[model samples]
Target: MSRQELPGLPTEATMLRDFPWVVVRMRCHFCRRGGDARLAVLAAKHGPYVTMGRLVVEFMKECAWAPWNPTRRPQKYGMKCGGYCMDLRRPDPPDLPPGMQGLQLIEGGLSEKLPAAPAEFERRKRVGSDD
Candidate 1:
């Protein structure tokens, strides 16, 4: 029954049945990031080969939009729940701000800086667009 906690997360981890990990979803804190995640406390450091996956196919028929639930669906349809991120339950609430990428507050940060905006492209800027 040993339990551990991450700084902003709100769950106590528990050992899983077969994997070398623990499960913790104590009070369901939503990630500001887009998807849902489960806490898997690892005893040993695993490589990038180790990953957390979300199941989305089952909800394609039920979702109002994809949120993009069904990863199998074609993107042209633009179903919000029909994409890569779906199963975000457990310790996180379904409501939260979008997740952060790299060291950025949203989307791309300094790590992925683009080349200077072309003169032609800059002329097309929208009235309220901040790019």
Candidate 2:
């Protein structure tokens, strides 16, 4: 099936199917393109990635498409790569299942089963933040 056919979200996470494996392709929020990989999925992957937190950190760590050097961000050296150089891009958070209730997901249609953000006021904000 095409990337669009798969549910949940791309590289960030996907709900485990009855099958053994899943191919993931998460888009870069910056460059807007991403590489694909095969991962062993088990369950829902939670996120506050849009606000850039642990979920974003783990996603970047796991994503094969991310740059290796954390301190020095990528620069296009005229197609030349060196000294931990690689592409620079951030992984967007994957969609959550109905039970967890995602923060910024699009609702209706295919996502009809998905619920709105949590009713508890605290749940609406990032897990740990002064904001």
My TM-score estimates for the predictions, one after another, are 0.18, 0.22
With candidate 2 superimposed using the best TM-score fit, by how many Å does residue 69's alpha carbon deviate from the native? 8.4
Ten-residue region with minimum lDDT total, candidate 2: 79-88
Residue 58 of model 1, lDDT score: 30
In the range 14-96, model 2's lDDT, one tens digit per residue, is 22242223444434454444554443331344422222122345455544345663654677752222111111122233333
Best by TM-score: 2
Question: To one decimal, what is the Cα RMSD in angstroms of model 1 from the true structure?
Answer: 16.6
CA lDDT, candidate 1, residue 94: 42
Root-mean-square deviation (CA) per prediction:
16.6, 20.6
Q: Quote model 2's TM-score.
A: 0.22
